[model samples]
Target: MKSLTAGAEIDAWCTKCRMDLMHRIVAMVQSAPKRVICLTCNSEHNYRAPRTETTASGVHVRARNTGPKPSPAAARVTQKARAEKERADSWSSKTLGQAVDAFTRYAMDKSFREGELVLHSKFGEGYVDKVLEGAKISIMFRDGARTLAHRAN
Candidate 1:
């Protein structure tokens, strides 16, 4: 590996020259490698090693944070929206046992074990921790904390 330093000449590919040309290191910025100014084309640009994170399957994995942060006012609106969505999505007035019953029946029909892994219609996704006596059961969800309910799937 070639170590780059200011004032040192390095062989860097020039977009204009279409070949590796000698370049002089000039300015460097934080979090990036040293800057390389092409001597032949007289152009300054930053150069970095081509890198990637690969999964166990050898597939490249890209991390992204696409969620937007909320400003104070925007946060209030978001909270209200979330509350409304919860109210809309909730099976209110219905007993949690009813949900468990429905989920268990579905799982049994599909040949899945009782209190197995499942997705919640509301609370995102989770796994059934265990089936308790009567209608109470425990569910471990992605949002953290275990939930005791009559049904979770």
Candidate 2:
């Protein structure tokens, strides 16, 4: 058996090149390459092996999703993204002209509560998700979540 170590040359499916390319091992765990940098394009990503699943007929079936399921935080982020998209779609139906007046104006020196929709002068419309200490609040806008200051005094 050959020893696989960092800096070792290996073959990996390059995400950038979209083909099997020679790579330099960037990280190794228990003699297995976990991360590699493609020598062809210098792109770094997890090393992926040819994925196959055996069926009852003993045929190697190509796997669809080879990686593990998304983590909880990632799932939450995805959910938040979906919710934001739904909100955006509903926003358009709510009439942007009048909707802008519906959203409470956001003020830096004012107070806000969670679930309160505020219209940011620059960030467009967003809803407060959390209120933190020091007058900082996490608000979800069209772009994404952001922490801003409020109630300076």
Report the number of the highest-lDDT candidate: 2
Clash total of candidate 1: 1
For candidate 2, list the clashing residue pairs, or say none: none
Q: Any runs in candidate 2 off by more than 4 Å, and if so which?
A: 1-98
Give the per-residue Cα lDDT of candidate 1 at 28.
52
Residue-wise C-alpha lDDT for candidate 2, range 13-104, written one tens digit per residue: 77788787889999998878999999999999998753221232244333553557778999999998999888777554443555555688
Candidate 1, residues 1-153: lDDT per residue as tens digits?
A: 666567877666665665667877786565344677789889887753322212322442323433365679988998989976664444232223345534432222232334455555666444565566645555555444354555323
lDDT of 2 at 57: 28
Cα lDDT of all candidates, in order? 0.54, 0.78
Model 2 residue 138 CA deviation in Å = 0.9
Model 2, residue 111: C-alpha shift (Å)? 0.6
Q: What is the lDDT, from 0 to 100, of the residue 7 in candidate 2?
A: 93
lDDT of 2: 0.78
Per-prediction TM-score to the true structure, in the order listed:
0.27, 0.38
Worst 10 residues of 2 by lDDT: 51-60
